[model samples]
Target: MVDQASRMQPTKSTSPTPLKVVAATDLLARVQRLRDSVARRAYEIFESQGRTFGRDLENWLQAESEFLHPVHVDVAESDDGLTVRAEVPGFRGENLMVGVEARRLTIAGKREAEEERRNEKTIYREPCSDQILRVIELPAEVVAGKAAATLRDGVLELKMPKAAPAKKIIPIGPNMA
Candidate 1:
């Protein structure tokens, strides 16, 4: 016999996971793949509609919606930097990737569904997988090398410090007439 209260207690070792930061080039490549998928789906939609020309935008939007899940994000700016918060429920930090550039930020994640069997016959099974991608343009430039990200409680937070403004230097020389 075990104590029910002790068995139900949550573990204290669980902590926020640090997200992996990838290069901007990698992010762009992933974006390109998503674009290709959307384009292919859009073409299929067009054929389904008898190759309609006037509804190209509609077909593209429908394709995007079908292939991607919308992510809710909030970006806040301070005098020194920017902070971004995104809702990514049911996603573990290991399943997510983040990329930051001077003027852009990208977040992408993919989670595969797991199956369990206890020697019981299955009645119905539905295929399920989750994927999300979002790219944001910053209002000000930032130091990409110093960016940091963490995921906890289904929320992802990113902190990026702003880049210093370029300084103009004037050469000191004798005045020329």
Candidate 2:
């Protein structure tokens, strides 16, 4: 309880401090390990979900895989441009309308069948040209302004030019003197 600092003579204080150095390679390896762990965990989740939804996935794949009837449509792309061809079968002029929104293309049209006597002996009946209203969104942006559609030989063909790549800036000299 005595006032030691006020009464006693001052002396120099000395102590040895601890220091440590860490290698950059060790830190990088630790970060890499952490990243790998997270990736592995993500894959594990995907695997579980894939297993659980296997049936639904299979059903969807199968349904989307084939063309069941004449109403089916096909889409193909080449270096020249994009081509959308649909099997309209018997659709007539001015009845089918093609629309383009942003990058999506839609075809909506009605197919009419002339009315027949219901009481008469029914030989047979088919689609009689069913209505076609198909809309597909493009994977990338398209030049919708220059888009064109034509129906020929019962196949609706849509020719679209893919969006041009952005141009680089051309630096100009500063106007200031």
Candidate 3:
């Protein structure tokens, strides 16, 4: 009689034994991981691009705002007069206009650069911008007609004499009537 083992025929396994199984699973996982990484990279790129765009837009807006808005100033007063001091570098009396209306004083003028100086490219131009428009409002009563301004040594100074306060007259009930 022939033994059962001798009659059996060997057949190859449909799937890989052990080593190939792990490799297949690893490959699938790696592919999925690569897809996730690509997605993340795309998101990162988009976010950074958005930030850059926003920063550029903000810079432009800031410049526009500054151009539209009025220039900065320092307004102060003294006992003798309403002294308005403005920071106007490279300015002279000719470049500033100070007008006092009632208690409000307005300073507006453009600093015109000498044609000869604009052409010369210097290392440092103090307040390269030669244009200025300044308006100052007084806190107290000011003598508009007597107001005078002097722009000297980059400081626009306005001398406004304060008006004397009017006395208040209090009226009482007429003789207890």
TM-score of each: 0.59, 0.45, 0.46
Alpha-carbon error at 172 in model 3, in Å? 3.0
- Summarize candidate 3's per-residue lDDT along 27-140 as a digit string, tens digits: 999878765654554454446557465355434443333344556666667776777777777666766676778777665556655434656778754553444444455688
Mark the regions of model 3 whose C-alpha exceeds 4 Å error after superposition.
1-70, 114-130, 173-177
Candidate maximizing lDDT: 1
Better of 1 and 2 by lDDT: 1
**Candidate that would win on TM-score:** 1
- The lDDT of each candidate is 0.90, 0.68, 0.64
TM-score of 2: 0.45
Candidate 3, residue 119: lDDT: 64
Residue-by-residue lDDT tens digits, candidate 2, 1-177: 768776697767787686576699998998787656545544444464564653554333322322123256777877756888887777876888888765798776776687678669978766454545566877656788888988888888888888877799999988997
Q: Residue 41's C-alpha lDDT in candidate 1?
A: 76
Off by over 4 Å in 2: 1-70, 115-129, 167-177
Better of 2 and 3 by lDDT: 2
Weakest 10 consecutive residues, lDDT, candidate 3?
58-67
